[model samples]
Target: MINWKYCIIGAALVVVLGMLFRMMFEYGVLIGILIPGVIVGYLVNNGYKNGAKNGIITGIIGGFIQGILVYITIDLNLPPFPAVISYILVFALFTTATSAFLDAVGGIIGALIRDKI
Candidate 1:
């Protein structure tokens, strides 16, 4: 059975880490990916496949939320709701796509580590 709780946890972790890394190192993905991956992997004893699935979910949720926040913080003067929604979706889709693969890889590694430990 799949545990969505871990997915939500992973997403929250990624979102928080994304902010911290972006502020400190200017590179956000690394901090978000491996940490959440390992956490999900450790908490859930599923194999790498499942780990990857959860990690992808985490990336999608976290990335989209972060995207919305990013759009809000940006100086884009588009104040209308629909326009803002469109841009948010676009930003989210791009960020999710960019982060998903590495996030999945992190999941795989994390699962492997879990198995070893």
Candidate 2:
């Protein structure tokens, strides 16, 4: 059986790392969304055998929400509609890709440590 608690813990850690990456790299537009998506993906993949779909959906939703918050947090002044739309697209794409990748990575890692876990 897989350990979901550990997966959650890993996801949490990844979130923090993502925040740090944003702050350090000064990522624009998408990384913030991508980070949360990746975290969700990591957790879902580790939690279940057929979790890829769930992970992708969860990551997309999580990333979108996180991206909205991050956008608000970063930009005090509201921009134009085009800018907002662009931001949304960039964020969605980043989250979708990053989360999918993280899901695969987490799955592999979980499998490797299954016995120890």
lDDT of each: 0.75, 0.50
Candidate 1 lDDT by residue in tens digits, 8-112: 888788778877777777566567656776787667778998888877887777777876776677646876888777878888788777556656776777888
List the lowest-lDDT window of 10 residues for candidate 2: 28-37
Which of the numbered candidates is closest to the native, going by highest lDDT?
1
lDDT of 2 by residue, 5-114 (tens): 54454445445555567677766323533444344444444443534444444444445444555566667776798998788678656764665565545444443344
Best by TM-score: 1
In model 2, what are the clashing residue pairs, if there are any?
none
- List CA RMSD, all candidates: 2.0, 5.7
Query: Residue 115 lDDT in model 1?
Result: 94
lDDT of 1 at 44: 72
